[model samples]
Target chain A: MAEHDSGGWTLERTIPSETAIGSELVSGLLAAMQEYAWPAAELFHVQLAYEEAIVNAIRHGNEFAADKTVQVRLSCTADEVRIEIADMGPGFDPDSLPDPRAEDRLEVPGGRGVMLIHELMSEVTYHPPGNRVTMIKRRPPSP
Target chain B: MAGFERLVVVDKEDISVVRFVDRKIIDASEIEQLGAELLSLVDIQQRKRLLLNFEGVEFLSSAALNKLITLHTRVKRAGGTVRICNLHPQIREVFAITRLDRMFEIASSESAGLAMF
Candidate 1:
């Protein structure tokens, strides 16, 4: 695991792909994030987004392989916060997923994590080969 | 980056309401802790009603929704009811996308939520 201090308002960490260990690792990273004076709502958004992304990495990206690892890096400034979750799994097309809002699929469960990430964060992008996802949320400027 | 507040209100009738007073964010671990607390309350009581007031929560993620489902299922199986009230437009969109809107009873106001019992 790798973590670094990008001056103030930013912290980053990396972890293995083990699902059980990944969850607790990300949870601790989120707890450290709370030390900053971020708005309570954004804090929750960040935590949830992190969980969804990291869990996906451990489960989908690495295919639950205990040998592989995932990388999570968080960067925050006075104006925004960005988190990049990268995994060793084969990347998939983000466009290929069926729309969760489609009338025919309204009753189906699961498949909302990606959509939720898009709604909560300002940006969500993916890189191929490595199956890495980078999510960003811009905090409103201080009054 | 909106401010967030959460409260657990217990009525004289033994009903417990968990209110999300502001936008729930990534830093709000208290919300999860609150869920565990609510579950414990259900374990101790045979029948109770839980009203989750989302008056100011503008957005919710899958993680948050999972916690809600966890609480709802636990409370319901224990002879309790969980109702959600005052979903912001964005939050409603989340519910619609996840189809959770169908799984839980949603109300526009606290009174409406309390009326579910």
Candidate 2:
């Protein structure tokens, strides 16, 4: 996809709810971040957020249904990076997710993905039903 | 000694120093395999101490974090211990954000991790 509204580059893909396909999409997004010279720390944040979103889409949202697919749109610019992911499966409420950091839930392995995404991204929002998520990380001002 | 596709395990005294094969541990199947291999050290081989050395890991998702937490749980249940060391700053930030840094015993170097045992 052509860069939208002065973003240096944009990518849009509808990938199957499969791990291998999701990994390729993540690699492409990271490459764009590298090309834009995002700092190493910020790049990790983007990578973590995107990976978690895609995996959540496939595993939790789509339930790995062969018939379902995940829609992904990524835009990278000098000023900020944005990605939107949506799955076709039944959606759930994000607020219902227990805090993985809570003493009672700290040992639970699966609930940390959404927590980490919110922690690392500059901004995160879940649309109605919570099957779709939008995350943005603005570039930090140069020292 | 069992063959390992995702880990390079070295014995240092009573601890097994484990290093990951991939720089970014985000792949699903790989993470599953990694979790299995790590648990094998405690379950099958009966290792009591594990020190995961994160010298080369640059990026990892929460899936990978889940594996580490599982490993920690299994090891502790077996009356063993898990210590992680050499995390790059960004990786360290992930643990901090998840509060896993508090859950895990983190060391600055291999020697320090070994010293914990």
The C-alpha TM-scores of every prediction are 0.62, 0.95
Per-residue lDDT tens digits of candidate 2, residues A63-125? Answer: 999999999998888888899999997888888988999988888898988888998899999
* Candidate 2 ranges with C-alpha deviation above 4 Å: A2-6
lDDT of 1 by residue, A1-117 (tens): 434455644455667766455555555445545656667667666766777787778778888787888887776655567888889888878788887767675445456677767
A-chain TM-score per prediction?
0.83, 0.93
List the lowest-lDDT window of 10 residues for candidate 2 chain B.
Answer: B57-66
Clashing pairs in 2: none
Q: Report the lDDT tens digits of candidate 1 across residue range B1-117.
A: 122235545563655666654464333365566555556656654436777788767555565666777777777677777788888766675676577887788888887888776
* Docking outcome class, model 2: high
Report residue B115 deviation for candidate 1 (angstroms): 1.5
Best by TM-score: 2
- How many angstroms is residue A47 displaced in model 1 relative to the true structure, after the best TM-score fit? 1.2
